[model samples]
Target: MNATRIGAGDRPRLYVSTTDTTDVTGDLDYIAIEHAINGEPVSLTTAEKVYTAQLLDSRGLTPTAIGRLIGSDPVTIRGWKTNGWQPAPTGRPHKASEAGRERAA
Candidate 1:
């Protein structure tokens, strides 16, 4: 599935209203994605993820740079780019805390 555009007059970004793990039957609005970079676990709403990806893209920041900015893996950041803010696929199993964030609802 592709992304859905967010509100107007805000930074242009796209979010997944449905995903591989989520569909119209569920509402995941309260769920937040967190990634520990350095020491802090940065929390981000789905919109934040989209904005983040676009922000980095607009600035021409590579995945390495964006990974450091959000405390995620560079490969994961690249996954976000390809997945378009759905979730950063680590290409490996995620820890318990890292689950759910991979797919937005």
Candidate 2:
């Protein structure tokens, strides 16, 4: 991961400001979303997605909202919740990397 990439746990829930017209956290998320929508190479790892999914779930955001933010569907988000946000096995064996580490191919 890049040193500057926003990790899933990095930002707090966006709060309305009393005087300012801007919410930094929300702005950052929007920027990321725009970049992704523009077909940029920004990608979140599965672990990152899991962390964010759990965070959003805890914040009471519905599956649709969380899915829009995280670039997944409501079904997948619900499945992650059912599995406790841990990566559930797909029942297929993982491929071995050149370093002999098992990873999704």
Candidate 3:
């Protein structure tokens, strides 16, 4: 059997900002990026998060699809989508964007 391995080239290079908004190379989990920075006050900025969400919304995709499209974790995409601004729903796996996705395909 041939085993597939993810080398350094296959992994994503994440850059978390410092107190002055400078990019620093690090491998922080995609989902915890906002918590690490915002919770700890590490140069607070929502530019990337918001931008990613906008792209996903414009493309009419769910967090899973957008995550795959941008090489980000699906949970992180969901985090950006429902981040503090949006209201949470009780139902699981919301299909609000699913219809649009089918149309796009």
Best by TM-score: 2
Which ranking of candidates, highest lDDT first?
A: 2, 1, 3
lDDT for residue 27 in candidate 3, whole number 0-100: 27
- Which parts of model 2 are misplaced by more than 4 Å? 1-42, 91-105
lDDT of 2 by residue, 48-83 (tens): 566666766786889888777768889988998998
Colliding residue pairs in candidate 3: none
**Cα lDDT tens digits for candidate 1, 1-105:** 976543334544333333433334443322232222111346755445555655566668777776665556777667677886667543786576666665543
Q: What pairs collide in candidate 2?
A: none
**Mind giving the per-residue lDDT tens digits that candidate 3 earns over 1-105?**
977643324544433333533334432233334333222223223444445445445647776665544455677666666765232444678586997998899
Q: How close is candidate 3 to the true structure, as a TM-score?
A: 0.31
Q: After superposition, how far is residue 38 of candidate 3 from its true place, in Å?
A: 29
What C-alpha lDDT, on a 0 to 100 scale, does residue 22 get in candidate 1? 34
Positional deviation of residue 84's Cα in model 1 after best superposition, in angstroms: 2.7
> Is 1 or 2 the stronger prediction by TM-score?
2
RMSD of 2: 13.8
Worst 10-residue lDDT window for candidate 2 reads 30-39
Question: Which candidate tops lDDT?
Answer: 2
